[model samples]
Target: MALPAASVQLYSLAKEFTADPQGSLDRLAAIGLKNVEAFDFVRRPAEIRSALDASGLVSPTGHAPLLTDELWTPDGSIPTPAPEVVFEAAAAIGIQTVIDPFVAPERWLTEEGVADIAERLNSAAEKAATFGLNVGYHNHAQEFVASFGDHTAYERFVSLTDERVQLELDLFWALTGGQDVPALVSRLGDRLTAVHVKDGIVPASNPWAPGAEAFGSDSLDQRHAGTGEVPLAAALRAGSAIQYAVIEYDRAPGDVFADIEASLGFLREGGFVA
Candidate 1:
């Protein structure tokens, strides 16, 4: 199937965005990006909107860090608007979804805990609905690893969250968690609002397998989309029903722009997207 015009997560280039938001957006736009998924804890919606407009890109969704105790801490918080403010911003930006990228550490386990998180998400979804936007949870490997004995915490979330709540599956993380991306997508169906398109490989060197980097540098775990071990084409096929597929790389080997450009080339020519 031919892929739609692609969008990228701005956080992947946080260094550049921080140094020069306007220049970074322009550079990305020049690289053929029609849309962007921005992440800035300090920048307001108005500031983002102005920058995006200047760069000739639109944001159909925003990365709203999930509400958790960790977010109350310094390093994890994103400047989320108040519910009313978020609604107003969504209305102005034409954003349909707000993706919460990480579950707070304290909130990642147990049936009751999962239920509590679901209730919170459901409430957010409800509030967002009033603004014509939806709330979604974005996953990481932790979600897949944190399990309730038999089922993974991710499974718990999927099973418990209200139908209105959506998911933004990160295919690479799904594989890292040892879950079947296609199966999960099939199960979730329309509940999947968007996806993060990237690739991962079974590490041959295993940087962190035994005695590796002092802090365990397993950078090989993540690679540019379509260039690693993940079955990206298959994943994309499964997400055909989704509304958006945003390209991302948590760590770029060298140039962030080059990584994104190469991934885009692969996505367009490798049959994941047109």
Candidate 2:
């Protein structure tokens, strides 16, 4: 099956990116990648954009917080700016989609909380249009912690959001949350604009469930694409409209760039990308 353009989420090499943005991007470009996913860039769009221009890399999708007071990552938290400010920066950096990468686990367990997320994203999506941008959400295992009726909080949130508010499901996290990864991807249909093309063994325990609030990521042994538990090929085949097959790692199993190259090779060998 024909696949989306292959890209790497910059967060996969956060240390290298922070220490030497230009060198880091050049290194990825050397790996034969022309696209990358931006993370935590709402604060320094111009700086990042300059590097992208120099390196000839395009950031079509990025991570930012539009609904929450702050965004959290394994590294730390970033206070959010107004949605309009975010859109301006995203537009400046030439990002087509600004995807909120995480929301706390506590927020996904209730009806009111899920609606609030959908409402905020829908409002943001409307504002994003003026900037020639799209808004989306990226999932972690927490999104599946609670089920309303027969569906997960993740599914409920998807149903509530406007179609313009899209999704980027993290496959490894979905498996970590005890989901049938490929089936879930298909269920999302065309709303999935991109997916965190993660491949890792699901931990023996689903630690991000509602009560397990102090979830940790150390247990996740993320491997190269197609080498772990996630059914990446099946899932990729299901996303008919996916625009980017983004490689990522919450924690690198080894040298980060080498791991990225390995995933890119998997994409090529699987014919998941050109």
Each prediction's TM-score versus the true structure: 0.85, 0.96
Question: What does candidate 1's lDDT look like per residue over 1-274, in tens digits?
Answer: 3354578888778779889888998989898888888665323667777888888899887776556533331133455556656566655765667777777544664577778888888888888887788888887665664578777778888888898787889887777667777887777777886788887674343221224343222244567787787777777777646777788877667689988888888777776654
Query: What's model 2's lDDT at 126?
Result: 93
Show model 2 residue runs off by greater than 4 Å. 213-216
206 in model 1: Cα distance from truth in Å? 13
lDDT of each: 0.72, 0.89
lDDT (tens digit, per residue) of candidate 2 on 1-274:
3468999999999899999999999999999999999988988999999999999999999998887898777657789999999999999999999999888888898999999989989999999999999999999888888899999999999999999888998988898888898899889988988988888877776666645535445656889999998999998988877888999998889999999999999999989986
Query: After best superposition, candidate 2 residue 251: deviation in angstroms?
Result: 0.7
